[model samples]
Target: MQTETLTLNGQPFYIRRWGDPALPPVLLLHGFPEYGGAWEPLARHLADRFHCIAPDQRGYGRSWAPEGVQNYAMSALVADMAALISHTGAPLTVIGHDWGAGVAYGLAMFRPELVARLIIANGVHPVPFQRALAAGGAQAEASQYINFLRRPDSHKILAANDFEKLLALFSAKMDLSWLSGELRAAYKAEWARDERLNTMIHWYRASPLQVPEPGQALTGLPDFPRDKLLVRCPHLLIWGQDDTALLPEATEGLEHYAPDLTRVTLPGVDHWLLHQTPAEVARRIKDWMP
Candidate 1:
């Protein structure tokens, strides 16, 4: 594995690269409470065949994590990625998980030219995700944590006690065995950086997504241009049936947005399926990559 710092929108975004640069590039985007290193396990499996490029993304790891909720707006987050992709000067297969999926879908919908293919690991599309989040059902309940994370006091509370609450948030009914002792230390060390945790929480704060409470649906959601939200490229979705943070319902109408979509479900795994079954996930991605 190799590491480098690429400036995106004047911010130094740290990236970890694996495999020969001459190979086809597969851009990997990580979610919350994790960094580019989170893909180290999965990249190891695909290193021989693909150039696995994983970025720490804004507000995580060694990347330039700015302050304020406005800094983490989805547009800004996606723009950072768009610049990174533009820097590559070629369309590439992109893989995303959790919040990373948000930006991935943004690229597919808004800047389709930069994405050759889209692969989502336990991620959701905005339209389906928004409908589910507003439905006040299972997905709404699952996403209530987003509200908690957006709270102003959440950072201080999560920071207290050596980030005990943050750790619990990560293992929420998911398999974390893939996060070994060394990996755990790495994550904790990243979180320990000044204001990193707060900047991380800002992502939830800046998001326009709303999580309605169970039995109480939301009305008058922000107008989203559905016509422009289509995923115009081949899309692959890898699902972990056991995920608790985002139930299957959240991604129900994914096919509507992604016409050329293929889904592969892996049983006995949860949100952290990439870590638990990196080889299998890599095989699925490799088999599906076009």
Candidate 2:
């Protein structure tokens, strides 16, 4: 893979590119606590057939991370992606994991013309996630960390003890064997960057989803207009069943918004499926992409 710095939306966006630029493009987006390089393993598997582009979205890695909570809003996140696709001058397949999947869903909803196909790995659509969070059950308990991350001083806590708390967030009943000592060192180095940790946390802070207490009742969760948020493109959702942070309920009723949706559940895999099964993830995407 080759790394390049490009100017998008007047900000320097770092991206990892693989394969010939003349081939079909596939945009890859990584989630929090990880950068574009996180997709390296998967990109290598698909490079022969597709041109893979993974960006260090706004607040992570070497990308331009601006200040203020508003900068990390959903609109800004989606626009950043729009600008990136426009830079390529073509509509292409988009794949995201975790928060990255959130941006992909937003793109499919608001800018469908820019995405040919959508592939999401353990990402949630707004409705089911908010409903699950507000309903107050296992998902709500699993998401309590969002409240903690939203705290103003949470960055300090995450940075303490060499980011012990942050590391714990990545491993939750999922496989950790893939995260070797070298990879762990690399992640720590990436997290140790100046302001990156705090900036990345802003994604959680800027979100509108409400995570209710385990048994608390919710009242004011934002209501999404079904018509405006429907995704028109062909969509594929790949889920890791053992994901503790995002329960299976997150994918329930997703087809209401994505009429042409294909769902695949990977048993025994958890949130770190991308790392645990990169080749399998690539195969699923290749077969689904056409």
lDDT of each: 0.89, 0.89
User: Which parts of model 2 have CA positions greater than 4 angstroms off?
Assistant: 220-223
Mind giving the per-residue lDDT tens digits that candidate 1 earns over 16-50? 99999999988899999888899988999999999
Q: Could you tell me the C-alpha RMSD of candidate 2 in Å?
A: 1.1
Candidate 1, residue 50: the lDDT equals: 90
lDDT of 2 by residue, 108-180 (tens): 9999899999999999999988888888988899899899999998989988998888777677566777877
User: Which portions of model 1 show Cα errors greater than 4 Å?
Assistant: none
